[model samples]
Target: MKLQPNLLLRLGFRQNARLRHFTGVGTSLVYREYGDPQKVIVRREDVIPKLKDDQVLVRMLAAPVNPADINTVQGVYAVKPQLPSVPGNEGVGEVVEVGKNIESELQPGNYVIPRVNAFGTWRTHVVTTSSEIIKIPSDVDIAMAATIAVNPGTAYRMLKDFSPLNSGDTVIQNGANSAVGQAVIQIAATLGVKTINVVRDRPAISVLKEHLTKLGATVVVTENELRKSEEVKSLPQPKLALNCVSGQSGTEILRKLSPHGVMVTYGGMSRQPVTVPVGAFIFNNVTLRGFWMTHWNKEHFSHPKRHQMLNELFQLAKTGGLQPPNHSLVPFSDYHIALKNAMPREGMLCKKQILIF
Candidate 1:
């Protein structure tokens, strides 16, 4: 029998009685020009394009207001989108309608996440292909599912790729309170590895330390404290260092690594280049490398291990071994508030804000 596109969509419309099923009008946060996100992001609504035989229509559930999303909007990120682009990088979405000829692997009501880094997600709906998205467990926690791409995925890869660590082994990282850093702590805890998390001193230092400690950080200390404390000096030297804040903060963490240690640079929050003493590299034989989740995904998207890694992470999330980052919600209409919260500011590091459709 010949396939029929109109009838397939017509039947899908009958199955799901939502109004958008027909009109395809949906909202989005768009930026025609790149700069500061707070000034450029605006709300727009339009009819979603018709789906190709391989495409699927998805209703965005929740999209994270990630720092990378802000950086991308500023035109400073390593990866930049074409002009007049939609502005979010990661989120969980529900499959609302599938193209008539789409593979049975994707179906209406299934959950999915973007398959690539720059698949803009700050919208109420998305029209994408089976090749552009990967199915996720429908019952997974929304917040956790929305954020699994960049942050936790980074932590998981760094932990596995760097130094050869085993049960009872130790790793240290700067930006201890960051989403990725917390994932490091929790993942290490689950694997019987220890984490020494270093954060900058702030008024809320004690509270942050307490929170990270509860997440299984073996030791949480300020940059200043890490440099001066005898207590920190007593623990087993770390074989791996994860640096998100490059600057003296990264140097402080790098200086604490054990001989033959490896430091992986994944982000530069402090906007300062990583600096280390010559002796540490020469005598300690320390190695430096960098990891960008974007690049990794491009290289490994079809690798069998990619799914294995995600399965492990999903298991952790389902079992409560891994938790989502602390975050506040903003309805899609109030995206400006989420954008503003994502910017760097005084006071102390705070929870990320997410856009709820």
Candidate 2:
């Protein structure tokens, strides 16, 4: 049949429109107002809208409850979302359907993760534009893939961007037992950089030190030990210091820097300001900087370096060079448990909580 080009185009559009008509309902955790995450966020089964020509329907596999997610819900994070929002910032999912006009490489059954924040990943399904998500290796561990975008990416960027580190170069950091801290130790080790990890002294300090050591930390010391330990003093002064626990701990890390060193503060677990000594800025020529992963993502959303870093992290996860931190998987139905476990409790070490569908 000889058809006009315009008629052919119209027919194609109709077929694609028919494909977009399919719809279903899915579970989501929604919040109408910012408050306590556990208080305001509630579960609801909402109708999943029909797919648009450029969108894909993803069936979520798992998502983690991060501290930032809690802060966002509490209206304390630097960036805020409009009310009646979903909470998760990152997760991994499978593409169950694709709109007929999607031009990207995404396809049914491909694994993907949101490339940006505020994705509202704490849901059973989502219909997102193909451009908003990026495909991940289907073979990688789902839990590791779910977490790869943030903590490990933070570790990777901090090491590569802040300094020109060579093999045997030393880096010092507090919050050594944190997820990001663990990532720092492993990534630094892979680059042949030595890390002097610092953590608060706890009842099970030995176990914690041994665990970090096995993950490639060159040295793990309690906050008190960091000040007086001769072993730490024997190592070359670190050219870089990572501060997540700002306050007295941050000050101590600053005191240990080498000449012309840089200290990059990425977190304030202590909720205190990073106080730099006058002598450090004047005498040693050290620089103090801050990093927010969310801000970094906004700046580098389309930069090649962002994807390059992600690919490297994926390879590390596949090869076992990078491992997901201590975590406990809670069923999606037990979201309350996940929320409760994710909250900070005095004197208790909390394992990351992942909600599995």
Candidate 3:
């Protein structure tokens, strides 16, 4: 007297409210077409099919709503998934079941995260190939694990790859209030590197400055202050400049770079092109570059550096050296609330939103 898969899922959804453990059914925020996430993404529940020989069943614990996730849903990001896709780029989950033929060391109860981008992490459960996910240290905070692979990884790599920064070296950057910027401050502090953090002015500028300063920013200044402040002018010119906000902000940081310094542009929060002065390149020999974590992962798929970076970040989390960005945890059932808070609005400082399953 075996029941059908759909019927089994229906029963599981009705009977198991806590979701403390996997029950062969899960919900997902799926978008059938490219549009605004709020207008297109909908929650749906379905049966969890049995695993293939190479697949593993993961009970998702938590996932963050990153800006990239929103851009991917709107069909504007560099990486677009096929329509009718789930939208999530990073998350942490627990292994609930493993296919019998799995040859790797993965087993039930191990915590894992997708090794590749666009793995559809905004779901309650996932069945993915063994190679698609990688195990992470189980002791780290779930929120930190859920958010680590993107922002912190970006900060770490930009510091290491673009230049040979040693202790006491200075790095300057715009968008200091962003998650990646905060990570840069903390990671740089650990290495004894100094950071000049530039952020937009707000009504509560003092509070923002305090927050970033606590995170290890040597100095926090607004865009206008970056231009007029004698303090900024007096410090040693940075060898590395990190630009996430382009337009005038980008040029401001570039002007502060030392001769033969490097500037890495990873994002354009202002949606404006980066403007560089001719003298900065010709006279100063400054270099301009870009970094995309997804592309880096693709190029270094099996590189040992990837594992080393992850382990170092995990250690930082355990020791409180790296902290999860300011965030709000919204229950997975209240996904609409999370979306509303996460969506960008004029003059609004949105906290990172993590969905707890």
Candidate 4:
């Protein structure tokens, strides 16, 4: 067929690669320096980038206000974005235009999420390579899609990579109310693995326990309970422990691990170091390791296993093996509320604040 000028305008969702078109530009939450998000990030309207031969243009639909995204802006995260960069690190976007010679399935209107870190996903649009965007089912929830890369992937990897778990094996983790913790409960339930989830003691504790129970947490306990409750002693020795709240929450969960089991530390939500009894190291023979999804992605970007794992996670969401995180949407223009909501207030912080552009 003869090629038409500006082909991107004619294609519904499968626009031909040769048609280059522009949707003008977009607004981005940009920061020129590392500082508080409220002080560093500002509204900036800029021209959308022209597509390069190997690139595809994506229109961002939604991006979540994750703590890591905030920490990166504050210069606290281990991975910092170069100055004068956008702040979002993970989100869901749609292909709106593509380079004339781009060779991939990322045609106009296709749904995709960034396949790599530091792609600056917190904006209205982005110009990224076809190979850097992971294709997702077009019909998936945009909010769920935006938030998937970090939490679910971390939970999935921690569940599978750190230890060898069988159908009946037990796993223990702290921060059971966190996004990753919720994911761990659901994913473990799907795999028939039992989970003993530990959360902080708080008012209306039963409400939180009921919520996690619905997601299939085999047992939900408070820090005090995990440490001293007789109920905790009745369960089998957990073969694996996942720790994100690295203080007392981690300490108690680590003590419950079966001898020779592994404890994987992924975060320090409490801003405290992980400490265990000397006896744990000397007598229990427990192994301690850490996982960073960013490092893992850097190592596996080109590997088929990366794609396979992402695909499996998406499939799990599609089939209800997972439930989307509790999220409150904020318009791109009104991002102040999003930032405020993302912060811990009155000691509660599990709800996600998402930016919808």
Candidate 5:
């Protein structure tokens, strides 16, 4: 049958549509040396990034400025990239070009989120293996997708890995107001498990409680409340404790767990050691385990499983159940100003900040 050439163009589409493309022709953000957050050198210029045959080129749509990302740029993070390297840890993008072999797995126009620690996600484009970019649901919020790769994934893994907690089981975590903590609360709630959340005192305690409670936290207490509340002492002990705050604050989280409970420490934001009573480990059979998202992502999951996990996370995001408290969305042009405002803040004001092109 003979086809009419203009037929497709007439079906609500423009025939000569142009998509903005990026190449190594000019510089994106790169660090020559690490110093201060404000002064850690970054240069913008054009230099072609080599791509593997199994890789794809992504036009970055949006990226979040995570604490880890900032730390890496400051050269204080655990995993440091080579000098003069790009320094973004996570971002969402649309695949613009795909290599031959990965054609079945990825294609142009697919939305994806790159794995955390695969730095350079902050650029106008990222070249990465097909296996590294997790295809996200297109209808999912780009801002949410940009922030999902790390906190939500980490929380999912920690809950599943750190011991089996069935419905009705209780878990406690300090720093429960953190992104991961909020995710943990909602995910656990969806699984029918309960959460006891602990947070540092913020300006508006009642408002904070309402927020976490709505996210399915059964109990939300300030550190001070946790330290002295007789009501909390009478409550049922948690089977697991997730600690991000360290030092004495973390130890207090341990005190709320039942005997034989496991405490998984994923972050040490407090810069203090997690001190537990010697008896908690020796007599109570409490276990303290460490979890690093990078190490777990590397050692535990297969490529296919990792991809499936990402799909599940996006499904959660689609329902509006999983989300970071969005602080702001900055365009690619205002990246400098956005980066400047990305400092650690307090209360709800300290929520996640996403950089959107």
Candidate 6:
């Protein structure tokens, strides 16, 4: 018996005329080592990836160059893959085709974002299962939509999990300049919660404070002020604190929390271990926990929950409550320039840079 067209599609295929005349190939960015951007290898038109029976084809739209994405390439993240692997962790794409037997809640032309592990997204397209893709709202801009996966997802999960936030309650966090930190400030504001943000003292402290305050932060304190703030005693003691910078910075955040409050640590961007005072654990009843986006996505939440969470985020974005920060857009053809521009920088200029395909 001959295989049906449906069966052929199910086995990773489409009915293009080229399917009969030529081989399909996809181009991707691959990195083999931990070093500078020059170390990255751009392999174009390598192989046109085929979808499995349960998978769909996503035409790449836009993807951001996040710190974690860079870290993965550097082999610093906990989830390092084998050498010469594709390098993007999150991206937004449109479903161009679906396998015949694929039963996806997602449809072609719909914008979808996915957090697939080590399956390089710095490509013209990606082939992944329906389980990995989250349908995005129609109104969300595809460029801003590209940033929805890791940073925003981390901020949302941490705020929701660390403690129950109420109106007028305040949360403290370091790395207030990070993308996730900014999202936390905005989301907390939208929820009627307040934020006490901490950052290193820069030359333009006033300007930085104003920027954060505009983002809904109740208070913006330098690291030095955080330690000496007799003012914090009068304010509502923070019930939740987020620490991406570790070491003494983390300890200072813990010191400011209310009794029995929790501090959730996500990243160690400071390259320091969080040091906690013995008194915080023994007397204050404080709990210290860690959050890793990969761990939470893989173990705690199911695929459906991930989709639902993103849907809620989109609703917030559409309402103008959870707006994304200013972004620099680079075309896919200029990916080399974009890659160079994405290097770790010290000063403030562009907050987030996204690669537009």
Every model's TM-score:
0.93, 0.93, 0.93, 0.92, 0.87, 0.88
Sort order, lDDT high to low: 3, 2, 1, 4, 6, 5
Local accuracy of candidate 4 as per-residue lDDT tens digits, 149-194: 8999999999989889999889999988999999999999999999
RMSD of 3: 4.7
- Which ten residues in a row are the worst by lDDT in model 2? 7-16
Error of 2 at 261 (Å): 0.1
lDDT tens per residue, model 2, 299-357 = 99878998899999999988889999889989899999999899987555579898887
For model 1, where is the 10-residue window of minimal lDDT? 11-20
lDDT (10s digit) by residue, model 1, range 321-352: 99999888788788878877788886476888
**Residues 21-138, candidate 6, lDDT per residue (tens digit)?**
2125556777777766546655665665555667787778788877777777767778778887777887788777677676656766687777555556788678778877767775
Q: Which model is ahead, 5 or 6, in terms of lDDT?
A: 6
Candidate 2 residue spans exceeding 4 A from truth? 1-22
RMSD of 6: 5.6
Candidate 1: RMSD to truth:
4.6
- Ranking 5 against 6 by TM-score, winner: 6
Residue runs of model 4 more than 4 Å from their true location after superposition: 1-20
Model 3 lDDT tens row, 63-158: 999998988988999998887898999999988767778865898778999898899988988989888898998888889999999999999999
For every candidate in turn, the CA RMSD to the true structure comes to: 4.6, 6.8, 4.7, 4.0, 5.4, 5.6
Worst 10 residues of 4 by lDDT: 1-10
